[model samples]
Target: MSANPLLAADCQDGCFFVDGRFVPADTTRDVTEPATGQRLGRCAIAGAEAMRSAIAGASAAQAAWAATPPRERAAVLLRAAQALQSHFDEGALAIARETGGIVPKGQHEMREAVVICQIAAGLPLQAQGQVLPSTPGRLSLATRVPHGVVGVISPFNFPLILGIRAVAPALALGNAVVLKPDPRTPVSGGTIMAEAFARAGLPAGLLQVLPGDAEAGEALVTDPRVPMIAFTGSPAVGRRIGELAGRHLKKVSLELGGANNLVVLDDADPDAAASAIAFGAWFHQGQICMASNRVLVHEAIAGAIRERLVGKATHLPVGDGASGQVALGPMIDARQLQRFDQIVKDTVEQGARLEAGGTHEGLCYKPTVLSGVKPGMRAFDEEPFGPLVNLVTFRSDEEAVTLANQSQGGLAAAVIGRDVARALAIGRRLNAGMVHINDQTVNDECTNPFGGPGLGGNGSAVGGPADIDEYTRWQWVTVKDAPPAFPF
Candidate 1:
C-alpha cells in the first residue's frame, strides 16, 4: 500500500497554522477523499475567534515583513518555490486525493502554482513608484506600499493555484496573508502552502493558514484589520463577499465563477475542435472556473462535432483518482454531484438533447453533452463546475458571439478557426478576459492578467503586473531642502 502523501507534509493531520506554528483547534473535522470517502486526515475547523486571531497575528507581522529588503523578500519566495518543487510528487498526490482531481490535473495545478511563486519572486524587485515633476526646490515621488494584511479565501477546485496566485504576490509585495482554504480540501489548499513557506524560512506570523467554514470566511471579510481580500469561488458567495467587503470598505480582488465558452467556427476541423472541446469541458471533471461550460458551434458542423463529443464522453475512464486508472475523477463531493445531475435534468426539460452521459455512480459523474441548449436553460445560464457540455449552434459569427456573451460571465473564451485574422477578430469581439484564438478556454499562465468583466470578476486582475497593483497602495511623498511657503 502506498503511504498517504498528505502525511508526508507533516501539517495535514490537523491543527491551524497560526503565529508560525501548528496550533490545535478547539474543534476538528475529518478530511476525506471525495473519490473513495477514505479518511485522509483531520484538520482544524477554525471558527471566528481563531480566524480573528490569525488576522491579528498577520497584522502584528506586517511591518517587519514589509521592512525586509526587496532582495531578501524575493529570495524567500524563490526558496519557497524551490521547496514546493522538491515535493512536487507528494503535493500532486495530496491534491488528487483531497480534491478528487485526476493525477494529471493535480500535476498541472502543481506546476502552475510553482511557476506563479517563482514569478512572484521578482515582483518586489520590479520598478515601483515614480518620480514626478516638482517645483525647482522640491522633489516629488509616488511609491507603492503594502496593504498591511490581506485575507485570502480559496475554493476546493484548483485550490493550490488559485490560493498561491494571490498569497505569493501579496507576501512578495510585503503584505501579510491570513488564508482561509475551503474546509473540504484544507490539506492541499492551505497546509501544503504553509509547509513550503515554513521550509523556506519565512518569518513567524507572515502567513497564517486557517482552514474553516463560511463563518471563518465571513469573519475574515468583515474584520477591519484585513484591509484587502483575495477570494476565488462561486458567484453567489462572491457576491456576498463583495457586499460585505464593500460595506467594510476593504479593497477586494474577487476572482469569481465563469460560464466560459468555446466557439467552433465553420472553418475549424471537426477532429481538432472535438478534441479541444472534450479537454476544455471535461478536464478535471469540469471543476475549473475556466472550464468551457458552453460550446458554440457553427450550424454546418454541429452534428459532426456532437458525434465526436459523444464518442469521447462515452469512452472516458471514470473512477477514483487514487487508482490511477481513470481519466475523469469524482466530483469534489456529493453536493456538487447532486447539483450536476439536477442541472442536466433541468436542461433536458428545457428541450436540450442529452446525447451522452447525464449519469453518475457515486461521485463520479459521466461527462455529459447537451445539444440544442439555449438561453434561459439552467445549463446555459448557470456556471457548471462539473462535466456537462451545453452545445449551442449558431449560423453566423455575430450570432456565435451573441450566444457566447449571453451568459452573465465574461471570463475566459476561445475561437476555433483556420483563418487566423478572422478568428482574432471574433475573439476580440468576445467580452472574455482571456481569449484563445486556436485553442480552448482552459488556459492560464503565471504572467497573464487573468480576470474577466461582468459576473465573472470585479475587473481587478491578479498575475504579473496586475499583482503589483492589486497588492499595494500608492503613497506620494515630497522632499525639500527648506520648507516651502504655504498658501495658508
Candidate 2:
C-alpha cells in the first residue's frame, strides 16, 4: 500500500462517496501509476444503478442546499479551501502518481486547485444581479439563482483543478453537483474532492463523486435530474455531449480540444522564442488542451529558432515523476503513447523533417520536433496532445495569423515579438478565445475567462465571474405594495 495518506485512505475501497459515506461499487478496477506501471490500488467503478442513485440523491438534496444561507455556503467553501491547503503534499503526490505529471506539474495543479476553491468561496455572496427602476410604487429586481443539479465531467489531464473549478463554484452557488471524474485519475480527480469537502462539513448529498468510464458519464449527461452539464475533454466527446444535452433540453458547457499556436515574429529574440516554445509544447508531456501544438515562426528567423528548439528538445530529462527531477514523465497509458507516436510518424512520413528526439523507452516518448510542418499535415491540423513540436514558417505577419486561424479550434494562441504594439495588433486579428503577447499559449488563471470559441468550446467559460454565469440562472422578480388593478 502506498504511504500517501490520500491514496491509502480511499483507494482500497475504490468506492463512491454517496451521501457523505463510502458506498461499495459493483465493480473494482486496479489503478496504476503511469510512470512506473506500479499498481497504486483499486477503485470502485460506478455502474448504471449507482449513477441513477447519485443523481436522484442530488436532485432530492438541491432545494435545501440552495435554501441554505449564502454566507454559510461561502463558509463551507472557505473551510474546504483550508482543508485542501492542509493536505497540500498528499494532494500533489496523488496528482503526480495518477496523471503521470512531473512533481512540479502536480504542485502547479494543487496551487490552482487552492485558488479555485478560494475564489469560489467568495462567489456565493458576490453581487449576482441588479435592481431595476420600475413604475411608481413597484419594486423590481433581477437576481441569479442556482440551477438545481449540475453534472460535471472532468478529464484525466489536470484532474484536480479542472474538476474542482466546477464542483466548488456549483456547490457554493447553492447547487448540488453530480461529478463524474475520468476513471484514469479517479483518486486525484474524484475522491480527493470528496475528502476535502467532507472535512469542511458540507451537507450530505450536496456533492456526489462518481468515478467511471464513458457509460457513467453518459448516464450523468442523460439523467433528467441533472439540469446543467459542464464537461472538459476531447472535441469528439464534447460534440456528442452537446447533441445529447440538446435532445434532453439541458444546458451544457463544453471545454474541448485545441490545436493551439505560438507565433514567433521576426523581431523576437531567438533564445526567448525557443525557450517558450519548448516549455509550451513539452510541459506535462504536452497533455493539456492549451499546450502549443503548432509553432509558427517568421521565415527570416525560422532556422535560428528551429536550431535552438532542437537543442532544447534533445536535452530535456525524461523519467519517472516521483523522483521530482524529470522534465517529462510517461504518458498516462500505453494507448496514449502509441497514439502520440503514430501522429509523429505520420507527420514525418508526410514529408516534414524530424529534427530531434522521436524515440521512446517504455512509456516516456522523448520530445520530438519537426520543421517544415504545413497546414495539410496531420501534425499541423490535429491537436497533438503529446510531447511533439510541429514547426511551420510564415514569411509575413498576415501569413502567420492566416495559418494560425486556419485551425478549427480557437482555444488559445500567443505571439512573441519585441514590438509589443505589433504583437498585440497581431493578437487582435487572431480568431482565438484567449491570446497572449510575448508569451506561450499554456496560460490560465482561476479568475480570468478560460476557454475559446469554435471547436474548442461552446462559448462557455470557467473562472470567477464565468462560474457565476455558468452555475446560476437569472430570475426577474417584481412586487407591489398592494394588488394592482386588473385590466380583465
Candidate 3:
C-alpha cells in the first residue's frame, strides 16, 4: 500500500506569528477536516491587541528592510521559496485537513508558491525607475519606493497563494507586510507561510500572519499605519474596502470574484473542448474565481460538445479530497454545499436540463453539467462555485460574444476554435482581464499582472512586475547646483 501522505500535527490550539515569534492568542477556533469531520488543529483568532501589536511591529521594521540591498532582499525570498518546497508535504497535509483539498492539489500549490517566490526575488532588478531629460545643469528623475507597510487580506479558497501574492511582493519591494488569511484555513494560509519566511531568515517583524474573522479584516483595512492594501475576495467586500480605502486616500489592489465564461466555436474540436471544460469547471469543486460559469457553444455544435463533456465529467474521479486520489472534494462547509444545492434546484425548477450529475452525497457534490439553461434563472448567472456548470447555445458569432460578455464579470475568459486568428480577434472584443485564444477560461502565471475588470477587480493586477506598482509608489526628484531666476 502507498504510504499515508498525512501526519498528525501539533498546532497547540492557536498562536499568532508576531515579529518572528509565535505568540499565543487569548482564544482559538477548531479547524476540522472537512472530508472526514476529524479535528485537525486550532487557529489563533487575533484580537484587537494582537492586531495592534502586529501593525506596530511591521511599522517598526519597515525602514530598515527598505534600506537593505535589493539583492539581499531577493536572496531571502529565493530561500523562502525553497523552504516551501522542503516543507511541501507538511503544508499539503495541513491544507487537506483544513480545506479538503487533495494532496496533489496541495503539491501544485507548493510548486506554484515556489515559482512566485522566485519571481518576487527578481523584482529588485525589474522594479527600476526612469530618468528624464532636463535643461541647464538640472537633473530630473522618477524613482520607485516602498509604501512603508502593506496590509494583505486573502480568502480561504486559495489561502497560501493569495497570502503570498501580496506578501511576497511587499517584501520584495522592501515593505513590511501584515497578512490576514481567512479564519477557516489558518494553518495552510497563515502559519505555513510565516514559518517558511522565518526559516528563510527574514528579519523580525518583516512579515506577520494573523488569522481572524471579518472584523479583523476591517481593522486591517482601517488601520492608518498601513498605506496600501492588497485584497482578493468577493465584489461586495471589494467595494466596501475600496470605499474605506478611498476615504483614507490609501493605495489598494483588489482581485475580486468573477463569473468566468468560455466561448466554443463550431470549428473547435469537440473532444478537446470537452476535456478542457471538465477540468476547468470541476477543478477545486468550482471554488476558483476563474472557474467556468458558462460554456457558450455555437448551436450547430452544441449537441456534440454536450455529449462529450458529459462523458468526460462522468469518468473523472470523485472521492475523499483529503486522500489525494480524488479530483472532486467536499464543499468547504455545510453552507457552501447548501448554497450549491439551492442553485441547482432552482435552475432545474426553472426548466434547465440536468445533463449528468447534480446529486450530492454528503458534502462531495458529483461533477454537474446542465444544458438549455437560460437567463433569468438564478443559476444561469450565479457563480456555480461548486463542481457545477451550465451550457447555453448561441446561433451566431455575435450572439456568442453577447452571451460571453453579458455575464456580470470580466475576470478570466476563453475562446476555442480551429481558426486561431478569428478566435484572437473575438477575444479582443471581449471585456476581461485575461483572455485565452485556444485554451480554457482558467489560467494564471507567476509573471504578469493577472487581475480582472468590471466587478472582478479594482483595475489592478496582483502578480508579476505589476505587483511593485500595487505595493509601492513613485516619487520624482530634481537637483540643481543653483536655483534658476523666475521670469516676472
Candidate 4:
C-alpha cells in the first residue's frame, strides 16, 4: 500500500480552474477511492453558471491561441509533457488509488500520458496541407484552422492518459478546451494535468477542468458556445451526445464502448495465444473499451486455448490497487460490480459455461472466463465491461471473422497466427477499425489511429498526426494575379 494518504489531504477544500485560477463551485462532490470505498477528496461540481463561465473563458482565449503559431502552441504541450514526467510519481500513486488500477499499470499509464503529450505537441509540424493546381498567376493554398472552443468528456478507465490524449492535440492545434473528467476518479488525475498545463505557461482559460456527474456533462455538451465535443465512454451516452450535437449542428468525435474479439487460429501457438488473450481480457480488470471480451477460436484449437486461458485467468492476483505485484484490481465502483454480476448470471443462464471466476466482494470481481458462449448469449452480444471473457468456437477462419463481426461494436479485433499472410487476410475481413496479428490489441502507439468503426465511433479517428488535423479545419486561400475580374 502507498505510504501517502488515499486522498490528497489538501484537496478537500480545493476548487477547479476556470481561467488559470482556482475557483470554487456552488457545490462539491466527494470522490471515493475504489479499492477501500473510502472518501478521498471533494471536487467542485460545476454548476450551470460555472459551465457558462468556463465556456466563455474558452471562447475568449481561443482567438489568441489560434493566432499563436502552431509551433508555439505545440511547445506548450511539450513543456506540459516534461512537467508530467517530473511529477509522475505522485500522479501515478493518485491514479492508482483513485481509479483502482494496479501500481505498475498506473505507472505505465502515467508514462504513456506524458508520451501522448509529447506526440500531441509535435502535431504542429505534422499538420500538412495540399497545394492544389490552379490557373496561371493564381496562388492557391489550403491550411488547417482551429475550431475555437472544444469540450472533452473522458472516461474513468484511463482517467489521465486518454483525457490528455484528446486535450493535448486539441490545445496543440490552437483550440481552447473545457474538460469534464469522469466523476468517479476525478481529483489526482485532472489536478495533476491542470498543474502541468499551468507550469507549461498555458494562457489563462486555454485549458479548464470541470469535475461532476452526467448533469455537468450534459451542461457542457449541450452548450451552444462549446462548438466541438470529443467523448470517450459508453455507447448509450455516445448516442445521447450525438443527438445533442446533431440538434445544434456541432462537430463531435466519439470513441464509444466495444465488445472486442480475439480470434485464435488453429495454426497459432496455443500457449502464446492464451497468454496474450488473458492479458487483453483482464488488464485494468477488463474495464478498458479496447479490452478483448470475446475469444473466438477455431474449433480444432478451442480445447487447448480454453485450458490455457483458464489457467492464466485463475492465476491473476486480485487485491489492493497499490500492490505492484497484483496484476488485477477492483472495478471502479460497487455499481459496476453489480452490473458485472448481472451480466455473468445472465450469460450462465443462457447456456454458457463458467470456466473460472464470477465471485464478487464489494467493488472487486474475480477475472472471469465463460465457454460455449453463443451469439444469443448476453455475454456474446453486449460489452460486459469487466474482466469477463466469453469463449466461442468456430470451424473456419471465415466463420471466426463472421463471429467477431457479429457484434454491433466494431472497435478492435485480434488474430493470432504464425502465418503472417493468413493473419493479415483474416484481419482484413474483421469489421473493427484496428486489428493485430499474433499480438494483443492493447499495444497502441501514439502514432496509430485508435478509433473504431460502426457503433464504436462516429467516423472520427484519434491519435496519429491525423488527429491534430481532426481538431482543426481547413481554409483555402486563393490569390489572383489581378483581383477577380469583377467583384462577383
For residues 97-138, write the lDDT of model 2, one tens digit per residue.
Answer: 899998888888888888888888898788978899999999
lDDT of 1 by residue, 1-488 (tens): 12433345354467898888888778988888989889888888989999998898899998999999999999999998987877788888889999998888788878888899899999999988999998898889999999999999999998999899999999999999999999888878888899889878899999999988889999999999999999998888999999999999999998887678899999999999999999999989999888999999999999999999999999999998867899899998888889889989999999999999998999999999999999999999998789988899999999998888787766799999999998999999888888999999998878989899877789789998799999999999999998768999
TM-score each candidate. Answer: 0.97, 0.98, 0.95, 0.95
Looking at candidate 4, the ten consecutive residues that score lowest on lDDT are 1-10
lDDT at position 417, candidate 2: 98
Tell me the alpha-carbon RMSD of every candidate: 1.7, 1.6, 2.5, 2.4
Q: Please give the lDDT score at residue 95 for candidate 2.
A: 89
- Cα distance off (Å), candidate 4, residue 116: 1.2
Over 1-488, each residue of candidate 4 has an lDDT whose tens digit, in order, gives 33543334564344777899667667887888888878877778877677878889899999998889878888899998888777777778888998999987778877998899988887777735778899889988897878889999988898887788889989988899999888776665477778789889999999989887777788888898888899998998999999989899888999986668888888999989988888898899999888888889888998998898788777888888886768888899878888888999999999999999989777778889999999988888888889987889999888887788887766888889889899899998887878888887676887888888867788678898568667988889888767656666
Collision pairs in model 3: none
- How well is each residue in 199-285 modelled by candidate 3, as lDDT tens digits? 789999999889888778778888899999999888888999999999888888989876787889999999898888887788888
TM-score of 4: 0.95
What's the lDDT for all of these models? 0.89, 0.89, 0.84, 0.84
